[model samples]
Target: MKILVFCGFIFFLAIFPLSGAGFELKTVIDQVSRQVVVPAAPQRVIALAPSITEIIFALEQENRLKGVTAYSDFPKKALKLPKVGSYVYLDLERIVSLKPDLCIAIKDGNPKEAVDKLESIGIPVYAVNPKNIETVINTVVEIGGLLNASKKADALAKNMRHRIKRVEALIAKTDLRPGIFFQIGIAPIVSVGTDTFIHELIIKAGGRNLAEGPVSYPRFSREQVLALAPDIIIITSMARSVVFEQVKAEWNKWPNMPAVKTGRIFLEDSNLFDRPTPRLVDGLELLLKLIHPELINEANKCL
Candidate 1:
């Protein structure tokens, strides 16, 4: 689906033709939903998702950023940016008031109605779907091409790929794959199923996900989780330490569980594991180390 465009303006500066950086940029295609044009040197940009904001900052295009959705605070400077709304639902009026030339979004996170409304208003919205680890990697490259920062994007994508490969190499040398339970939500005991980025990363990080439900995020009962017999339990919560610890303590009641008996439960930074950004690599490294303590030293190398 790669189309060649005139990169006459970008060709001479930091030329990265492979990532489609130069005088030309390609249209963003999202699951047959919409095609968006990337304006050359877009003046005002609005990021509708945290991950999109991180990508823009990674490419050092924060200056072009005029507005962002709630919780788009990765690069310290972003905190000062104006907020249009949360990724869950945007303040259309506020976003339009920003007068951005381009608005970035996530197909899964942003409401289609909102994106369509923005498009109708003549503001270009480029939405990407990072459904899996591979698509997450591709996002960095694609975003870089759109911002004319192909070189930086290529390097970032290469680094993530290299780190992921390192984990895979370590996993290949191991025969024992631990069964892991990733607890994301406390109420109703929610966890990621096979249809999620976390699930894919768990498999790639040399572990088996115990919660294999139908949806991306599935609700599990206490008895159901106990039957799974997970070897390890990992918690990812954006809540305060007190709240997160309390959530972990809830699992403590099941002392007979293999994970509880072995004290294999771990608390991870929610920002790393929860976000579909470059930090997913960080999350994967930690996951690998937790699953195989023997790879603790090897995990550092991947990061």
Candidate 2:
């Protein structure tokens, strides 16, 4: 099955961007390992995860991307890059062959040994661990510092934070928030919980997530779903038509369900909510529209 979250549940632990720029020289700290001095502006970079790759593009540093893993298909041009491997397994040989000066890998999406191996070979590696929206925003700014593009990165981060506050304000105005259930997987139904970014998105979008347990992605029985009585049901598309159809069919079986009756069902892009990139704002905006149908026009204008 094509699960939405990466194998790590979150990105790997290390990503430290220290300030010291002049003639391509700066010391970077990793969340888990030793510090490494990177060239001020690394021209050849390898992105170990799709989220990292997305950040590189968001910073307008795509020209420096030497390699990326599979499923880094958003920008259209990324599909043409050399494939290092997937989020869990990376081809060490291919990555080494590319001779990347700097490697960016997620804490959870990448294996520690791979990152260690990259460093063993004298390749400067920066690991990132963005657990929440604030860290995600800070990480973007950190990346800018690492690449000597702090200004651009800060500008982007500022814009994102501004929009997020706007969304929060929008949610605050309405006293009635809908009970929401977001479906990520089918056949024993997997959904995000309190520990995941998706859960945070739901809250920020003004919807109360019914899956409130500590488990990042919890499984729910059909009976439990009925018990929760979600006013709205949202299904995520993982580029798979079969799973989506199944989710829709399963929910439709209960015509009396609040979500089914009210026609508040929605299908959203997995990338927008899954990846911790600038696109998260897009996800938030979309969710506001889905959860509160009345604010569709206002949400459209806010963005």
Candidate 3:
């Protein structure tokens, strides 16, 4: 009877571990979309988007980045990393050679087939799509969690929230809200409308978007733009040649426009404005300065 009891106790110990299982930790899901699962703390990470690379660097996980895309120009050190081609077209051979455990990509930037191929080869991929400022913060936190830098990510997110609140407070003190028109791409004349990250930024920067009614990025007619009569016109210098001289000359022809008459046309770095990362705080501060230079004190001029 003593031997049987001892055997039963051993059996119970073995089954207890399996039954309780210590409650397996739940994998975090990407908030933008529930489909993607954050991989367990990646060691060798490849950032397919410049924005993702910036976020990783902000989280101080630059050492973990095995490879980065061609356009990641920030931090200067990122330039030394091996290039994985452009966001739209990746160098599959180079990526496979690097043997990265995980690849971080943007939703629209990376191709579906490339992601599938990487997954088939036993590499995990986390595709992030941050449509607005709030989502951008969440993406950073998620990336941090995936990289085992949860504390850093939380701190970064908190800092960004505080900066945004400061900007909001400044805007609320004044009733002056300028009507803004943001130019995304010229030539065909693409502009940020409602439901765009840029549109949200404009609102946060204490400016009202002139391009409304249309949801996503839409091409505007010259006549339609004239009708909006924006108080301030902001153009992104994303293109190789920011042709500010040419743009100013063209706007000069439209004498009736408020922006043209008042010379409220300003140029901003497209990468900083368009990329949804921690640097976006810089862009917001710049936007505020441009929109209401009067609110900025003499000491804040350096900003």
Candidate 4:
């Protein structure tokens, strides 16, 4: 997972740029309350973050996407798009070369300087900041509105809400909240805190996050983790699959650990957990299944 931290969500409207041949220039506010002028029907757009690219693709607005940041390799087609560098370290020259009429950025990941520089050079940048599942759905809808795909965005948002409610309803039926140790970093042995998306998912999926605190992604020693005695250990890393298996094997050595004893240590796709996209709902359901296998049938029904 790309570690792009987030805050609360914001709502904004679309505006038309007057200079673009047939388009009119109009000012609109972004998620961060920054005023941007863009074309009403932007033909060339750039996604400054992988998650933003995913959202635009989900909205079926990829036709306007002229460029995307590195690792925006979802939907298969994004692989063919021009790269403007990663979200954190943006390539201003490459981005400017693309001649994009609009650029969608994530407030958390995309560097502020890059955004300001783009705006200064007459490139309209719309930003989004989605901190949790609910806001992520809102972001989908908001991006849809920005791209003239409100109908699709609304439908997608509705579907996301439906799935989230299903998880909530199913979770309400159980008092079984497993103590979970979610490891995101394998080298230094790090876990999510209460403020992170994974921690929120854990709680919503009926698992108690053992690493909940103020420090966001916190590091821990093996002894410290064992002392916590988590019921389930879920490891999500950007590392290769073999590395995950090796980590699992290492955890298996601790037979006394409940998760190892019960063969509950699992490896998951980090993107589903970290990316602030519609796929997070998918991650939530997966967490539900892992935390409570007994609810598999009911969870399927909920889906």
Candidate 3 weakest lDDT stretch, 10 residues: 17-26
Q: Model 2, residue 67: what's the lDDT?
A: 98
User: What tens-digit string does per-residue lDDT give for candidate 4 at 1-303?
Assistant: 122210010011113221354666677787788777778888899999999999999999899999998999887999999999899999877776676788999989888898877765567788988988888988998888888899999999999889888888888889989999999898899999999999999999999999999999999999999999989999987776997899998888889999988889888889999999999999998998999887878656767
Top candidate by lDDT:
4
Cα deviation of 211, candidate 1, in Å: 0.4
Using all chains and alpha carbons, the TM-scores for the candidates as numbered come to 0.86, 0.88, 0.84, 0.91
Rank ordering of all candidates by TM-score, starting from the highest: 4, 2, 1, 3
User: How does candidate 3 score on lDDT?
Assistant: 0.79
Give the number of the best model, judged by TM-score. 4
lDDT of 2 by residue, 1-303 (tens): 122222222122123122122236778686555687787788888999999889989998899999999999978889999998897999876776676778888897799888876675566788888888888898899888877778899899999989998888777878887899998877668899898888899999998999978898999999999999999998887756777677778789999899999877778788999898888888998898888767767657778
lDDT of 1: 0.80
Clashing pairs in 4: 16-24, 16-26, 16-40, 17-24, 17-25, 17-38, 17-39, 18-24, 18-25
Error of 1 at 177 (Å): 1.2
Q: How many backbone clashes does candidate 2 have?
A: 10
What are the runs in model 4 whose C-alpha is more than 4 Å off?
1-21, 298-303
Comparing 3 and 4 by TM-score, which wins? 4
lDDT of each: 0.80, 0.82, 0.79, 0.85
Give per-residue CA lDDT, model 3, range 170-263, as digits (tens).
Answer: 8887788899989876776778878877777888888888886466888987778888898899988655355776776777789999998899
